[model samples]
Every structure is written in structure tokens, then in C-alpha cells.
Target: MDSPHGAAVKAEDFGLKGPRGWAFRGVGIDAAPGSLIAVEGPSGSGRTCLLLALTGRMKPTAGHAEVGGHQLPKKMSAVRRIAALGPVSGVTDLDQALTVAEQLREGALLQRHYGAPVRAMLRPRAERRAAAEARIASALEAAGLDLAALPKGERTSVRDLERLESVRLSVAIALLGSPGLLALDDLDLKLSDTERAEAWALLRSVAARGITVLAVCSEAPADALVLRTGPVDPDAPDAPQDAPDAPVEAAEPAGAEGDTKNDTTNDDTNDDTKGADDALAEAGRA
Candidate 1:
């Protein structure tokens, strides 16, 4: 189904400052609905900050942006409600203790309560539940997650899921609310060459479905509209070096973090459908 509120993003010399200095500066982006845009840069180059700022999660110091028709740094709240982020450090990380099914169900419930319409709130319990299930089912299908094929099936805990599976689950959760725009961090973080290719294919498929996608990656695909960021320049006169108490930008390192696993391709069957089905059942139980 096509999105009722899909909106393009346009930024003109957009910039933001953090305690350490400018997280990102002089950035520009113009992406249409259903397009794929990549924010490419090294670690600590303020890519994440830029993602947050564009999505209305952070305020910018200079320049301006309009997301989904709302001017950013001003109508940030409106943009935030329409743009969803996943794998964002403090925003959408998975809980290691929860099973895959449990997480999906919880995400759906949260979306129903927080993102659903007033009519949905007043609907009969059964009708509301059916609607939620339909949403989860559609989202899982769209994300291409096969819950059954997971190592432990639907009962598989997040800690036990492989990196790719974890990524799929996070994407599924983000899609639960059907936001017009989706933003993801670390698109190729720990994947091997083959995995990275598969991940890119998946994102491409997403964009083809009419929802705009913004991805943060060390290296963006050839076809994506790319925006590059770099570390703050202290040599600039407006740099925060003179400030006695400027804080540090404690952002994560630029490339593939946390997973010390090898970058070589793994030929593990990409069967995520089974796990996705189980997750639906689990969500229903919740």
C-alpha cells in the first residue's frame, strides 16, 4: 500500500554543533518520496548527529531543512512523528534478554498505543487486536524477515540471533508504525561483502515500496543520493577551541562497531520467514 503522507526531505547548508564542536556542518540533502539517501562518512564525523537533526531529534545551529513538508529546527516535533529511526544508539537498540517474538509483539503494542488513531483506541478489543496483527504481518512481509528460520525459531532470543537477523528484527519494529520516512544507522556495520550486498538489496526494495529511506553507512551504494560528513575542524575561527568548557561529542566510532566477528561473507541461508511468523504469534499473545 502507498503511504498516505510520504514526504520528501530537502536541506540547504544544514548544520549542528555539539559540546566537542560542530557535529556536522554545511550539509545538503534533497530526496524525493520512495528514494534512498545515504549519509556516508567516517566514524565520529557527526553522521549520527546529522541523522538525528534531520529527523527532528536534535536542533541545528546553522542552516535549515524541511522534512515531509515541515521546516526543521522549528517544526521538529512534526518531522519526528513522520520519520522513524532504527539501530540508533539510544533510540532503537534491541534488548538482549527478549526473544525475537516478544520484541515484535511489544513493538506492535507500543505502536498501537502511541501511534494509532483515536478511532482505533475506541474500537472493540478484538477488532483492535486484529488490526495490530495485520500491521505486524504487513511490516514483517515488507522487511523480508523469516521468523521461522531463526536459530531457535520464534523462541530465539535476540542475544542468540545472528547480526543480520538482529538487523531485520530492528527494521521490522521500525516499520510497525508505518512512518512515511525511515532512517537507519550502521547499514553495513558488521556484515561481510555478501551480507552488505544483501542488506543494500533489502533497502532498495524498501524504497521501491514508496517509503523514503535514509541510511548511515561507511560506504554508500552507487545509486543512493549521498551526503558526506567529517570530523569538526578546530582550525576554523568559529571552532569551539576557545570555549573553556565545550563538551565532547561522545558518538560511536565510524566503522563496523561492537561485532568483532570476521567481515568475510557467511553463506548461512537467509531464511527469515519462519522467525517472522513466530514473532507474529508471540506478539498476538502479548
Candidate 2:
């Protein structure tokens, strides 16, 4: 991987509504390509939904956004092609059963099959195989994952690896596509202070390589661009303060398409599950 090109990300008045209520609204952000961006918020603040929507995995009800010059929602499919997900918990989980090598090999195969350029695919079988191998190696290097560091080297099972290793593996897998944007969740989960520092360093290195990185974290890094998320307050001076009872939504899929059939502004139903559920539901539509 000679450093995949990154995508510029921009959003304005971006918002989403679920059956329960608005996940987030009036959101604004601007980041250059190859920038390291941190999405900061509490558990149910719609951090995950914003990640999904920007990557073309979810839809927004109000406002608009662009990733890599492609408008969101309308160009979601295109964004999906340029964006790859990493460690999104419920959305993208590693198979605990697979060995490290197996996981990397599987990712390589998927990228070769679905994301390969026509010219590359036209190469001889052996050349193609070598190319995939090279790609896997490059991704592993870029992700700072060294197989020899594992107890059993390439044969180490995912379940046996530390949380940080798992994140590295997921990131490597996402890099197989050499995507313009890489989105990850829970960047600081289950890590000590030292580990968290190392994790941020890894992300910085990735961004330096020209891949825009969107990471979700409870604590925003001091150096990276930060995007904050929180429960939307309808009473905020800037919000529809007239809506006295608009409730903030929690983070969980309540059902498919949170009240897509209804106006999300009627979204003040004080339900949290609906937005997450709606995000999940709309994600499938992508």
C-alpha cells in the first residue's frame, strides 16, 4: 500500500431522526483529506450513526454531508466503495475462530474479488496471488501489526489477541481496499492509559499515510480534529425550542427504520432505541 489517497469530509446542519427521536442535528464539521478526526460523545450521542452515514451505511433525515467529494445519502453507494469500516462492534466483528493469517487472507480475497481493478484482475493467477500477498503484507505493516508478536504468530486466534491487537487486525483488513476513508469505533475501549496513547499514535501514522481516519472515542485527542456528539436538546436556543417534550434517543437499534414513516421531527417521543434501530434499518437499505 503506497499510502491510499484520503477523502475530505464536510457536513452542515446534518441530522438524523429515528422512531424515538433525533440522534443528532445541526452538526457541522470540516476535515481535510488525510486528517485524523475524532468523534466525541457519550454512548448514545449518535457518534456511531454519524460514522455509518458518512460511510454510506446509514441515511440522515436533515441536512447534508460529503465524503471524498461525494454527497452523502444520494451518493452513499459511491461513498461505500471508497470507505471501509473497522471494528464497528455490532456492525463489523472479527471471527474469533479465525487465525490471524486466515483473517488477513480472507480480507485479501474479498478485496481481490470485489474491489480489484479490472487491469489487476487480468493478470496471471500467480501474479494476482502475489499481489494479494503483497497487499496483505503492506496493510499489516501500515496497521503496525507484527504476526511474530502473537503467541502463535500467524496461527493466533482472534479471541486470544488483546483488544488493541484486534483493532489493528480490523484496521489492516479495512486497508485491503486501500480506501480513501477509514472509520473505526471505540478507539479507547478497554485500554489502559499507555495503550490508549499507542492507539492514537497508530491512527496518526495511518493519517500520515494519506488515509483519512474517522475514529469514535469518548475522549477526543488533543491533536486530532474533534467532532462532538450528544443528545439533541430541542430546547437549545438554536434548536426548535418550542418543542417542549422532544426526548433524546439512546444508542440501540429499536427496530428497522426508526419511524421512517413519520416525520423524524415528531422525533421528540423520548425514545433512544428508535434512532439506533432506524440507523440500522436504513443501513440495510444501503
Q: Choose the strongest candidate by TM-score.
A: 2
- Please give the CA lDDT of all the candidate structures: 0.68, 0.76
Candidate 2, residues 144-237, lDDT tens digits: the string is: 9999999999999999999999999999998888889999988999999999999999999999999999999999889999999876785554
Give lDDT for model 1.
Answer: 0.68
Q: Model 1, 27-145: lDDT tens per residue?
A: 88888898899999876566766776677655666778998898976776677677777676544678889998899888887777666667768999999888877877787888888
TM-score of every candidate relative to the true structure: 0.81, 0.85
CA error at residue 241 for candidate 2, angstroms = 18
- Segments in model 1 whose C-alpha atoms lie over 4 Å from true places: 1-5, 237-286
Per-residue lDDT, model 2, residue 119, is 83
